[model samples]
Target: MPYIPLEDHLPGITGLLEYSKDTAAPIRELTQTLLRGPSTLTEGERELIATIVSHRNQCTFCVTAHTAAADILLGEEETSTKVKQDISTAPVSDKMKALLTIASLAQESGKSVTPESVQKAKDAGATDIEIHDTVLIAALFCLYNRYVDGLSTVTPTDPAFYKGLGERLKNNGYNRLPEGYEHLKK
Candidate 1:
Protein backbone atom coordinates (compact mmCIF):
# COMPACT_ATOMS: atom_id res chain seq x y z
CA MET A 1 0.00 0.00 0.00
CA PRO A 2 2.96 2.31 -0.40
CA TYR A 3 2.64 5.29 -2.67
CA ILE A 4 5.08 3.35 -4.81
CA PRO A 5 4.76 -0.28 -5.85
CA LEU A 6 5.72 -3.10 -3.48
CA GLU A 7 8.82 -4.06 -5.43
CA ASP A 8 10.07 -0.54 -4.87
CA HIS A 9 10.30 -1.00 -1.12
CA LEU A 10 13.95 -1.66 -0.45
CA PRO A 11 13.26 -2.13 3.24
CA GLY A 12 14.87 -0.21 6.12
CA ILE A 13 15.76 3.34 5.07
CA THR A 14 16.74 2.20 1.61
CA GLY A 15 14.20 4.46 -0.05
CA LEU A 16 15.47 7.53 1.72
CA LEU A 17 19.00 6.69 0.73
CA GLU A 18 18.06 6.16 -2.94
CA TYR A 19 18.43 9.81 -3.88
CA SER A 20 21.96 10.07 -2.50
CA LYS A 21 22.99 6.46 -2.63
CA ASP A 22 26.49 7.58 -3.41
CA THR A 23 26.41 10.48 -0.98
CA ALA A 24 23.44 9.62 1.21
CA ALA A 25 24.65 6.10 1.85
CA PRO A 26 27.80 7.48 3.42
CA ILE A 27 25.78 10.03 5.38
CA ARG A 28 23.50 7.28 6.59
CA GLU A 29 26.47 5.12 7.40
CA LEU A 30 27.91 8.03 9.35
CA THR A 31 24.61 8.65 11.09
CA GLN A 32 24.32 5.01 12.06
CA THR A 33 27.83 5.19 13.39
CA LEU A 34 26.92 8.26 15.39
CA LEU A 35 23.81 6.51 16.64
CA ARG A 36 25.91 4.08 18.58
CA GLY A 37 28.98 6.27 18.81
CA PRO A 38 30.27 8.27 21.72
CA SER A 39 28.51 11.48 22.63
CA THR A 40 27.49 13.52 25.66
CA LEU A 41 24.00 12.14 25.13
CA THR A 42 23.57 8.70 26.58
CA GLU A 43 22.04 6.08 24.33
CA GLY A 44 18.85 6.48 26.38
CA GLU A 45 18.87 10.21 25.82
CA ARG A 46 19.30 9.73 22.08
CA GLU A 47 16.55 7.12 22.01
CA LEU A 48 14.30 9.51 23.93
CA ILE A 49 14.85 12.14 21.28
CA ALA A 50 13.88 9.64 18.58
CA THR A 51 10.86 8.41 20.54
CA ILE A 52 9.66 11.93 21.22
CA VAL A 53 9.96 12.92 17.59
CA SER A 54 8.30 9.69 16.47
CA HIS A 55 5.35 10.23 18.80
CA ARG A 56 4.90 13.81 17.64
CA ASN A 57 4.99 12.78 13.99
CA GLN A 58 2.58 9.94 14.72
CA CYS A 59 4.98 7.46 13.21
CA THR A 60 3.94 4.31 15.00
CA PHE A 61 6.82 2.25 13.66
CA CYS A 62 9.37 4.69 14.99
CA VAL A 63 7.51 5.20 18.23
CA THR A 64 7.41 1.51 18.91
CA ALA A 65 10.97 0.95 17.85
CA HIS A 66 12.47 3.77 19.89
CA THR A 67 10.23 3.12 22.81
CA ALA A 68 11.65 -0.34 22.88
CA ALA A 69 15.08 1.11 22.49
CA ALA A 70 14.46 3.38 25.43
CA ASP A 71 13.21 0.47 27.45
CA ILE A 72 16.31 -1.53 26.77
CA LEU A 73 18.54 1.40 27.64
CA LEU A 74 16.66 2.46 30.75
CA GLY A 75 15.47 -0.94 31.95
CA GLU A 76 11.90 -1.97 32.82
CA GLU A 77 11.72 -0.10 36.13
CA GLU A 78 12.50 3.30 34.66
CA THR A 79 10.74 2.82 31.34
CA SER A 80 7.49 1.42 32.73
CA THR A 81 5.86 4.72 33.63
CA LYS A 82 7.45 6.49 30.72
CA VAL A 83 5.55 4.29 28.33
CA LYS A 84 2.42 6.34 29.11
CA GLN A 85 4.02 9.70 29.80
CA ASP A 86 5.07 12.63 27.68
CA ILE A 87 8.76 12.42 26.91
CA SER A 88 9.40 16.03 27.86
CA THR A 89 8.94 15.37 31.60
CA ALA A 90 9.67 11.68 31.46
CA PRO A 91 12.20 10.40 34.02
CA VAL A 92 15.18 11.49 32.03
CA SER A 93 17.90 14.08 32.37
CA ASP A 94 17.10 17.77 31.91
CA LYS A 95 19.45 17.78 28.95
CA MET A 96 17.22 15.13 27.42
CA LYS A 97 14.15 17.32 27.87
CA ALA A 98 15.97 20.12 26.11
CA LEU A 99 16.71 17.87 23.17
CA LEU A 100 13.09 16.75 23.11
CA THR A 101 12.08 20.38 23.18
CA ILE A 102 14.27 21.05 20.18
CA ALA A 103 13.09 17.89 18.44
CA SER A 104 9.40 18.53 19.10
CA LEU A 105 9.78 22.08 17.89
CA ALA A 106 11.53 20.84 14.78
CA GLN A 107 8.67 18.44 14.18
CA GLU A 108 5.90 21.01 14.63
CA SER A 109 7.70 23.81 12.83
CA GLY A 110 11.22 23.65 11.56
CA LYS A 111 11.63 27.34 12.29
CA SER A 112 10.11 27.02 15.71
CA VAL A 113 13.39 26.19 17.38
CA THR A 114 14.42 29.51 18.86
CA PRO A 115 17.90 30.60 19.84
CA GLU A 116 16.58 30.57 23.38
CA SER A 117 16.16 26.82 23.16
CA VAL A 118 19.72 26.34 22.05
CA GLN A 119 20.89 28.69 24.77
CA LYS A 120 18.88 26.76 27.28
CA ALA A 121 20.56 23.56 26.18
CA LYS A 122 23.88 25.28 26.44
CA ASP A 123 23.05 26.58 29.90
CA ALA A 124 22.07 23.04 30.82
CA GLY A 125 25.63 21.99 30.01
CA ALA A 126 24.89 20.45 26.62
CA THR A 127 28.02 20.88 24.54
CA ASP A 128 28.04 22.30 21.06
CA ILE A 129 28.53 18.85 19.61
CA GLU A 130 25.63 17.51 21.67
CA ILE A 131 23.32 20.23 20.42
CA HIS A 132 24.46 19.70 16.85
CA ASP A 133 23.90 15.96 17.01
CA THR A 134 20.50 16.44 18.61
CA VAL A 135 19.44 18.59 15.69
CA LEU A 136 20.75 16.02 13.22
CA ILE A 137 19.00 13.17 15.00
CA ALA A 138 15.73 15.09 14.98
CA ALA A 139 16.04 15.93 11.31
CA LEU A 140 16.94 12.35 10.41
CA PHE A 141 13.99 10.87 12.29
CA CYS A 142 11.66 13.23 10.43
CA LEU A 143 12.69 11.51 7.23
CA TYR A 144 12.47 8.12 8.90
CA ASN A 145 8.98 8.82 10.26
CA ARG A 146 7.73 9.86 6.87
CA TYR A 147 9.25 6.82 5.23
CA VAL A 148 7.47 4.41 7.57
CA ASP A 149 4.08 6.11 7.45
CA GLY A 150 4.25 6.74 3.72
CA LEU A 151 4.74 3.06 3.12
CA SER A 152 1.41 2.01 4.64
CA THR A 153 3.34 -0.72 6.40
CA VAL A 154 1.72 -2.76 9.13
CA THR A 155 2.50 -1.63 12.71
CA PRO A 156 1.51 -3.52 15.79
CA THR A 157 1.28 -2.14 19.35
CA ASP A 158 2.74 -5.14 21.06
CA PRO A 159 5.71 -4.07 23.21
CA ALA A 160 7.56 -7.31 22.78
CA PHE A 161 8.43 -6.59 19.17
CA TYR A 162 10.25 -3.45 20.19
CA LYS A 163 11.71 -5.12 23.25
CA GLY A 164 13.34 -7.78 21.17
CA LEU A 165 14.36 -5.29 18.53
CA GLY A 166 16.20 -2.88 20.88
CA GLU A 167 19.55 -4.66 20.87
CA ARG A 168 19.63 -4.96 17.11
CA LEU A 169 18.34 -1.47 16.48
CA LYS A 170 20.85 -0.02 18.91
CA ASN A 171 23.60 -2.00 17.26
CA ASN A 172 23.06 -2.63 13.53
CA GLY A 173 20.11 -0.33 12.83
CA TYR A 174 18.21 -0.10 9.48
CA ASN A 175 21.01 -2.04 7.74
CA ARG A 176 19.76 -5.41 8.99
CA LEU A 177 16.03 -5.69 8.58
CA PRO A 178 14.03 -7.80 11.01
CA GLU A 179 13.44 -11.47 10.40
CA GLY A 180 11.22 -12.15 7.35
CA TYR A 181 11.53 -8.46 6.46
CA GLU A 182 13.44 -9.05 3.23
CA HIS A 183 10.49 -11.04 1.93
CA LEU A 184 8.26 -7.99 2.30
CA LYS A 185 10.30 -6.15 -0.30
CA LYS A 186 9.35 -8.69 -2.94
Candidate 2:
Protein backbone atom coordinates (compact mmCIF):
# COMPACT_ATOMS: atom_id res chain seq x y z
CA MET A 1 0.00 0.00 0.00
CA PRO A 2 2.43 2.62 -1.12
CA TYR A 3 1.28 6.16 -1.67
CA ILE A 4 2.72 5.77 -5.12
CA PRO A 5 3.13 2.76 -7.36
CA LEU A 6 6.26 0.81 -6.56
CA GLU A 7 7.79 -1.34 -9.28
CA ASP A 8 9.56 -3.58 -6.79
CA HIS A 9 7.64 -5.83 -4.48
CA LEU A 10 9.30 -4.65 -1.28
CA PRO A 11 8.39 -1.08 -2.11
CA GLY A 12 11.17 0.91 -0.44
CA ILE A 13 13.80 3.39 -1.44
CA THR A 14 15.32 0.82 -3.75
CA GLY A 15 12.10 0.62 -5.66
CA LEU A 16 11.97 4.36 -5.88
CA LEU A 17 15.52 4.47 -7.15
CA GLU A 18 14.92 1.76 -9.69
CA TYR A 19 11.70 3.38 -10.81
CA SER A 20 13.26 6.82 -11.03
CA LYS A 21 16.50 5.80 -12.65
CA ASP A 22 15.96 8.57 -15.12
CA THR A 23 15.20 11.48 -12.78
CA ALA A 24 16.91 10.55 -9.52
CA ALA A 25 19.98 8.93 -10.97
CA PRO A 26 22.26 11.64 -9.69
CA ILE A 27 20.85 11.55 -6.19
CA ARG A 28 21.15 7.80 -6.12
CA GLU A 29 24.79 8.01 -7.13
CA LEU A 30 25.59 10.70 -4.59
CA THR A 31 24.01 8.73 -1.77
CA GLN A 32 25.97 5.65 -2.72
CA THR A 33 29.18 7.62 -2.98
CA LEU A 34 28.67 9.27 0.38
CA LEU A 35 28.09 5.84 1.82
CA ARG A 36 30.78 3.82 0.09
CA GLY A 37 33.17 6.22 -1.57
CA PRO A 38 35.81 7.91 0.60
CA SER A 39 35.53 7.61 4.30
CA THR A 40 37.20 6.18 7.35
CA LEU A 41 33.84 5.55 8.94
CA THR A 42 33.26 1.82 8.91
CA GLU A 43 30.34 0.41 6.98
CA GLY A 44 28.56 -0.60 10.16
CA GLU A 45 29.01 2.87 11.60
CA ARG A 46 27.44 4.49 8.58
CA GLU A 47 24.59 2.04 8.60
CA LEU A 48 24.15 2.65 12.31
CA ILE A 49 23.95 6.35 11.63
CA ALA A 50 21.27 5.71 9.06
CA THR A 51 19.37 3.38 11.36
CA ILE A 52 19.50 5.79 14.27
CA VAL A 53 18.31 8.66 12.13
CA SER A 54 15.55 6.59 10.63
CA HIS A 55 14.51 5.55 14.11
CA ARG A 56 14.22 9.17 15.15
CA ASN A 57 12.18 9.87 12.07
CA GLN A 58 10.19 6.67 12.54
CA CYS A 59 10.98 5.78 8.97
CA THR A 60 10.26 2.11 8.46
CA PHE A 61 12.34 1.49 5.36
CA CYS A 62 15.55 3.10 6.54
CA VAL A 63 15.31 1.59 10.02
CA THR A 64 14.76 -1.92 8.72
CA ALA A 65 17.22 -1.74 5.83
CA HIS A 66 20.08 -0.04 7.64
CA THR A 67 19.62 -2.20 10.68
CA ALA A 68 20.15 -5.16 8.41
CA ALA A 69 23.11 -3.43 6.86
CA ALA A 70 24.64 -2.84 10.26
CA ASP A 71 24.15 -6.46 11.16
CA ILE A 72 25.86 -7.60 7.99
CA LEU A 73 28.77 -5.32 8.60
CA LEU A 74 29.17 -6.82 12.06
CA GLY A 75 28.77 -10.30 10.52
CA GLU A 76 26.42 -11.26 13.33
CA GLU A 77 22.68 -10.84 13.25
CA GLU A 78 22.19 -11.01 17.01
CA THR A 79 24.73 -8.31 17.73
CA SER A 80 23.20 -6.29 14.94
CA THR A 81 19.77 -6.28 16.50
CA LYS A 82 21.22 -5.53 19.88
CA VAL A 83 23.11 -2.54 18.60
CA LYS A 84 20.15 -1.35 16.62
CA GLN A 85 17.93 -1.69 19.62
CA ASP A 86 20.27 0.12 21.96
CA ILE A 87 23.76 1.02 20.91
CA SER A 88 24.92 1.97 24.37
CA THR A 89 24.95 -1.59 25.60
CA ALA A 90 26.02 -3.30 22.40
CA PRO A 91 29.23 -5.33 22.41
CA VAL A 92 30.76 -2.99 19.89
CA SER A 93 33.86 -1.01 20.80
CA ASP A 94 33.10 1.93 23.02
CA LYS A 95 34.02 4.33 20.24
CA MET A 96 31.47 2.89 17.83
CA LYS A 97 28.70 2.72 20.35
CA ALA A 98 29.40 6.30 21.25
CA LEU A 99 29.08 7.32 17.65
CA LEU A 100 25.80 5.48 17.42
CA THR A 101 24.54 7.26 20.51
CA ILE A 102 25.59 10.59 19.07
CA ALA A 103 23.87 9.78 15.82
CA SER A 104 20.74 8.83 17.69
CA LEU A 105 20.71 12.08 19.63
CA ALA A 106 21.27 14.01 16.45
CA GLN A 107 18.34 12.29 14.84
CA GLU A 108 16.12 12.91 17.85
CA SER A 109 16.78 16.62 17.61
CA GLY A 110 19.42 18.08 15.35
CA LYS A 111 20.35 20.74 17.87
CA SER A 112 19.85 18.43 20.80
CA VAL A 113 23.11 16.64 20.06
CA THR A 114 24.74 18.99 22.52
CA PRO A 115 28.44 19.70 22.80
CA GLU A 116 28.38 16.98 25.43
CA SER A 117 27.45 14.48 22.74
CA VAL A 118 30.46 15.56 20.76
CA GLN A 119 32.61 15.42 23.86
CA LYS A 120 31.25 12.02 24.80
CA ALA A 121 32.15 10.84 21.34
CA LYS A 122 35.63 12.24 21.79
CA ASP A 123 36.01 10.78 25.26
CA ALA A 124 35.14 7.44 23.71
CA GLY A 125 38.04 7.88 21.27
CA ALA A 126 36.28 9.39 18.27
CA THR A 127 38.57 11.30 15.98
CA ASP A 128 37.75 14.63 14.45
CA ILE A 129 37.09 13.02 11.11
CA GLU A 130 34.85 10.42 12.68
CA ILE A 131 32.89 13.09 14.52
CA HIS A 132 32.47 15.18 11.41
CA ASP A 133 31.45 12.20 9.33
CA THR A 134 29.06 11.02 12.02
CA VAL A 135 27.25 14.34 11.92
CA LEU A 136 27.10 14.35 8.14
CA ILE A 137 25.87 10.79 8.01
CA ALA A 138 23.15 11.56 10.55
CA ALA A 139 22.16 14.69 8.66
CA LEU A 140 22.02 12.86 5.35
CA PHE A 141 19.78 10.18 6.77
CA CYS A 142 17.45 12.86 8.12
CA LEU A 143 16.94 14.03 4.56
CA TYR A 144 16.65 10.47 3.32
CA ASN A 145 14.20 9.57 6.04
CA ARG A 146 11.95 12.46 5.08
CA TYR A 147 12.34 11.79 1.38
CA VAL A 148 11.22 8.18 1.63
CA ASP A 149 8.52 8.53 4.25
CA GLY A 150 7.35 11.99 3.26
CA LEU A 151 6.58 10.89 -0.27
CA SER A 152 4.74 7.86 1.05
CA THR A 153 7.31 5.61 -0.54
CA VAL A 154 6.77 1.90 -0.66
CA THR A 155 8.38 0.66 2.53
CA PRO A 156 7.82 -2.99 3.34
CA THR A 157 7.72 -4.85 6.63
CA ASP A 158 9.49 -7.99 5.46
CA PRO A 159 12.77 -8.71 7.27
CA ALA A 160 14.07 -11.04 4.58
CA PHE A 161 13.65 -8.39 1.97
CA TYR A 162 15.87 -5.99 3.83
CA LYS A 163 18.34 -8.57 5.20
CA GLY A 164 19.11 -10.14 1.86
CA LEU A 165 19.39 -6.75 0.24
CA GLY A 166 21.58 -5.54 3.11
CA GLU A 167 24.14 -8.19 2.31
CA ARG A 168 24.44 -6.92 -1.24
CA LEU A 169 24.37 -3.23 -0.34
CA LYS A 170 27.25 -3.71 2.09
CA ASN A 171 29.28 -5.64 -0.44
CA ASN A 172 28.58 -3.26 -3.30
CA GLY A 173 26.46 -0.23 -2.40
CA TYR A 174 23.65 1.92 -3.82
CA ASN A 175 25.90 2.83 -6.75
CA ARG A 176 23.97 0.14 -8.57
CA LEU A 177 21.23 -2.18 -7.50
CA PRO A 178 22.29 -5.79 -7.04
CA GLU A 179 22.02 -7.95 -10.10
CA GLY A 180 18.63 -9.59 -10.42
CA TYR A 181 17.09 -7.10 -8.05
CA GLU A 182 14.22 -7.73 -10.40
CA HIS A 183 13.84 -11.06 -8.63
CA LEU A 184 12.12 -9.29 -5.78
CA LYS A 185 9.04 -10.94 -7.14
CA LYS A 186 6.30 -11.49 -4.66
- Per-residue lDDT of model 1, residues 1-186, tens digit only: 455544353433444455335766666666566577777677777887787788888887778778777777777646524633775657766776777788788887778999999998888788889988888888888887887787665565566656666776766664534352455343
Per-model tally of clashing residue pairs: 0, 1
lDDT of 1: 0.70
RMSD of 1: 4.0
lDDT of 2 by residue, 1-186 (tens): 557777756466776776677856777676776677787777776777787778878888888888888888877767666776777787778888888878887777778788887898899889998887787788888878887887788766667778787887887787765463666675
Q: Candidate 2, which ten residues in sequence have the lowest lDDT sum? A: 177-186
Ten consecutive residues with minimal summed lDDT in candidate 1? 6-15
What are the runs in model 1 whose C-alpha is more than 4 Å off? Answer: 5-24, 77-84, 177-186
> What is the overall TM-score of model 1 with all chains considered together?
0.77
